[model samples]
Target: MPEFTYDMLVIGSGPAGQRAAIQAAKLGKRVAMAERRGVVGGACINTGTIPSKTLREAVLHLSGYRLRSLYGASYTVKQHITMEDLLFRTDHVVRHEIDVTLHQLMRNDVDLFNAHAQFVDPHTLRLIDLDKRGTRAMRHLSAATIVIAAGTEATRDEHIPFDGQRICSSDDVLQMQRLPHSLAVVGAGVIGLEYASLFAALGVRVTLIDKRQRLLSFIDAEIVDTLAHHLRENRVTLRLGEEVSGMEPFNDVSGDRVRIQLASGKQVVTDAALYSIGRTGATNDRGRISVNERYQTNVPHIYAVGDVIGFPSLASTSMEQGRLAACHAFGVEATSVPALFPYGVYSIPEISMVGRTEEELTAEGVPYEVGKAHYREIARGQIIGDTIGLLKLIFHLQTHALLGVHIIGDGASELIHIGQAVLSLNAPIEYFVNTVFNYPTLAECYKTAAFDGINRLGGVRQDAVATSSRN
Candidate 1:
């Protein structure tokens, strides 16, 4: 005789769901979470974030990509790398992350359910237990507050044959056995760009196609241009403004190949295809819920967060959304600052951005001046051999206040935070000019860029510049 009851119940164990459950538990409220995969961390840990990044590192190291500037192009650490070598680190890290997440949930005293959950009523869910014997035992769980964070699955075309081998979806790409000589990445989103960059570093010819004419329209045009140039240099073919009308997977004497037909009467035949067109929600729409300032739905007790709620679906923003939702549901009083949430794309020489973009500032008719730091000019950047790296800082022309931070280089994701902190505090460019940083560090780029900007504004005496640099 078991009664499954709680104050809050989260449907998925992803970043958003995990954070939501922990927040409610800390409030002394009964909390439980259901994960259909029988794993504590959802796609973010098991497949998406951890596996992809780990794979990138493996490719970069084995191929000697980062050190090519110093050691020459043919200086690979390993002569020939196999799928086993790539998966070795990814599998190990994923297992460790799962253990860590499970321990955190247990430490927080949140009940865990390894079952698929569906709402029987507005406030109740029928959790279908995942069983190996094909016999599923069901249970009804009731809660005062409910959160839907089931995440999403890769979208695949029915017309295209996907056996998880020669042709596969983004989710199945990691489970692949053999490495192909060529790859056709049929999307230009963050996932597609990252995967294309990784495989290209491994000497795979990558043809990246998309319906859009430009890459990352949200990113700064200058940064995108640099990335595009670098990608082309790495032997990645950009097929922008192309539409895939049809696809057929076939076998020839040379083995398997997928022939993709474009709308403009062109054909692309590649050894493998990673169909990452988009992601679709795994659960029902929950009555096509409209997400608002608060994470509440039309139904009083139900709430939605994370990728399920749509755009800017980053794990960073999703975690904050989950915490805010839990606080709002309990009337604990909280506020969200969407402007401060940073975006990081995990591509080769990954791009990270915060605050306004140059395009946005120009569109708004805001007066601004651009300050840029090239990695080649910095000591650390030369040591790292990231000559193409660039960091752009946008500041208001008159106020001299920092308006935006955009970086495309090595450790761009980590370095963006320094600019983010300054932007969040509404600090001026002089703060960077006056601040003293450790010598031979990438952080010195901030000081370099600040001086560059102040010089652009004109009227600064050499004495004044020297005095500020000393301080």
Candidate 2:
């Protein structure tokens, strides 16, 4: 066998790539990571996740949306919030994330290369230098194993005339020179909903359009219905079962206003429109590389993870995928990631869920019972003024084993983990009922829900009744 430059060569420096490189380095293997952007973190830190979430926090703080009920709906945190106000904190957060990522790579002794990388062969890569101006210097390196975590980019269609001023993608939302008086978001997916809710909180009239009749159908139907209700209350118009046929600038308007025509003969004029329909894998030409359960591509010794492989494309899951792939490459035995990890959508009223949905269980003919606790019924919920939040638990009627958990409200993302831990341990519903939680806390909902479910199972089989007591 020919001598290789490094044991592992990782492409892209996103969450997955960084984790893979660091994991291999920790194992005392020579590792190198190549990034085209000349930065340690990929689009996740530069454009997509970090920037968007930071902007969301700014909007919440400056808009005074959270205190509207207590302040009688006539209070504003700032008289006039501008684009600069929203981006001020975002810039700091991005810089901090990049610095931290770079420090991690340096401390682990992973070589960093700033260049565009392309495969010369299965075992070799060609790197085009990105730092030197106008000089086309190229370098080739071979490795024993390769991992691709190139991430994804926002999709754009030629039919849509995107001037970046009137018609923009989600990536351009953060770069706007000023806030729009009104906005139209052209997708009902996670990205679309998050941005729509954010801008709406800033007192912008937002119209969300989608061809699908429902939003986030994969989530719990009851939770989605609640989100839809809150969105409408926030003055966001939902144009479901509709599609944008075309769009053009409104000549009658002096400003940058666009007229969006729909297939349903409806017209909407807004200062700007965000087309967040979908995202494409960043892998050149071949699209997404297919991978097996081990995250290895069709070509042995080469692996792909994260958004490039699709489905549940989240930073948290991507990190785990990278670690698992690295362990497998070095012949280290490790447990696979759990099939039921949490899914979080960071909208105004966040939504999160773990395990199977009620729809899935019903379709599979699994005998299950649902227990629910509304925030309005809890003291902590009233103190925080989150009357709309809810916690729902699903359990097997026969076995009393916890099956699933769903939550929608503030801190939903963080709250879902408690239920996740219980489900992971294969614990029964009695665990919550038998335990005590701190006072004036949202976690007490678990105990409330457990008792609710137990009360519903009044006429269970005698054997099952005895099992509950023993548990």
Candidate 3:
């Protein structure tokens, strides 16, 4: 084998890049990590997952959304929560996360290069250093293995220009100078709904517009319906199936706002407009790496993972992808990440699920049965004044095996893990039905759903047996 300078070179410092680098370091490989940001932690910590989730937590706490029913509307001593209050914990959390990443790299002895890495070839990359402390402005490095976990960036179109003052994107939301009294979110996707819900909970008049007939068409219909109801209850005006015609800056007004014209010919004026249409892989248009099934780019030694590869742009999945890419590069055995990964939307009244959607099941003509339980039937939900949440279980009719689980409401993200574990193990609904869950807990809803599924399965079995007997 030809001698290589470094064992691994990881580009991008997001969850994927960080995990890949750390995993390679654990293998005692000499590794180098290149990051564009001055901070080591990528978008997940700085502008993406961590920052948004922290902001959501603050919004939930400040708006009294969690305790509204128990304490009543008057429970809000302060009617409004400032952007500062929401962002107060962000810098600390971001700093701590960055420190942790840096510590891991230090412990693993991975060289850190705060610079932009551009491919000179599959094995060689040119690094442009922006920091003045560095004497050399640019340098070339060679590595035996390369991992591209650059992640994804928000998309913007010329037709829908972003001023950040009026029209903005998800990344701009967290860094806003002031909170808008009223906001309009274009696109009802995960990021859009998340911000719409957050701003609405904080007393902002929010209107969420989506081109789809229903929000989250990718999710189970029941869960999405429930979530849509919650958004409406929170006073978020949803304009589903509406197309955006154009946008104009609102000026000569007491407050800065944007005017949006809908395809339905309705015009809306709002203090701020957010376009969360979608995200695109951060791969530069000039990217030279060829990506394969195992995440190998055209440059055989270079690999791409996470949002940059599209599909599931989840932080959890990206972390694993990073580790696996590193393992593959190191010629180590790596477990295949399951396809039945859970999708969690961190909006208010979170939605989460694992496995196939009902549409997919129906399209494939797979015979299946569904079992559902409302939160009101669960003791913990009643105690928490949550009657709006629900859990749905989907099972294969022939084998009685668990096919999928979907939920919308509190703890949905945490709860989906149970279903994910069962699905991964190919466990049947009986596992949930027979297993005892703690009394009055949200988990009981799953138990209830399991029993419902089992009963349905039994009905199908008995009917089949009768037909066989008749024959």
Candidate 4:
């Protein structure tokens, strides 16, 4: 084996890069991670997941969205909510999370390089020092294995003049001076909808525009509809099937405003706009490289994971990807089950799903039946003042096995794991039906939905169940 500065070199200190470096260190390999940001957690802890989620929580609390059911329709926790109020909680949480990431990496013996890593060659990386305290402006790093988890940057249109305040990208949302009285969010993708919901929750008039006629087409249609309805209830205007022709920013006596011209000749004037069309690779457009089952790129020693790989660009899945890639790089036995992973959208109401959607099963011509439990009927929902929540369980009608589970509402992200377990274990609906969940809890929805499904089956069951019933 050729000598190298480190056995594993991880680019970016996001969830994936952090996990990869830590896993390699645990394997007794010299691991080092290069982070362009002065902080360790990358976008996940700073601009992306942690900040957004904390902002959402702060919005929910200050806006009184969580307890609106118990109180009146016009109820509010605070009469005046400011950007500083929201950022107070968000900044605290983000700083703590960054500390945690930094501490974890330090304890694991992963050397940190606060520098931008440029590919010098297949086995070498040229680091551009970001901090002036560095003795050298640039340095070279060599490693036997490399993992590309630099994550992504928000994509911007050339025409939209972004001043970071009025016209901002998803990456700069946290940097806003103040909350806009109205917001225009272009593109109804996950990031768009998530930000739309957040601002809408804080009493901002949010107009969500997307070229696609439907919102979250990949999600279960019913769940999307429910989310759309909730957004509407929160005064978020849905402008679907609208293509933005252009944006004109003008400064008035009062303040700056932007007029978004649509292809349909309709125009919308807003205080600010968030251009969240999509994201691109942070380091390079290396997605063209082929990655095998082990997450190895065409360059076998190089691996890619997380948002850099696209599709399920989630912090949770990215961590698993990094772990698996590190293990595979070190010749450790590892397995991957991408199908069983859960997709959670951290919007206002929150949405989570595991396994196939009804649309997917229908397109595949698979025989399936759905059973639903509404939060309005659940004791926990009533106690928590959440009435619009719903849990849906899809079962293979003939086999009585769990096919999919989808939930929209409070704790949907946490609740989806129950169904994920059943789907992964190939457990039938009977598992939920027979199992006991705590009273006055959201988990009871599983039992309720499962029984609802079994009842619809109308005594029809798989041969095994029928035979057992007869005996």
Name the candidate, 1 or 3, with the larger TM-score value. 1
Deviation of model 2 at 293, angstroms: 0.7
**44-109: candidate 4 lDDT, tens digit per residue:** 898999999989899889999989889976789998888999999999999899889989999999
* Model 3 C-alpha lDDT per residue in residues 36-58, reported as the tens digit of each score: 87788787888888899888888
Report the Cα lDDT for residue 371, model 1.
81
Q: For each candidate, give its TM-score against the true structure.
A: 0.96, 0.95, 0.92, 0.95
For candidate 1, lDDT tens digit of each residue in 23-89?
9998998999999997878889987988999998888888888898888866788877887888999
How many clashes does the backbone of model 3 have?
A: 5
Mark the 10 consecutive residues where model 4 has the least summed lDDT: 462-471
Give the worst 10-residue stretch by lDDT in candidate 2. 462-471
lDDT of each: 0.87, 0.88, 0.83, 0.89
All candidates: CA RMSD in angstroms? 2.5, 3.0, 4.3, 3.1
lDDT of 4 at 85: 93
User: Over all chains combined, what TM-score does candidate 1 have?
Assistant: 0.96
- Identify the superior model by TM-score, candidate 1 or candidate 4: 1
Which residue runs does candidate 4 get wrong by more than 4 Å?
132-136, 285-289, 460-471
Better of 1 and 3 by lDDT: 1
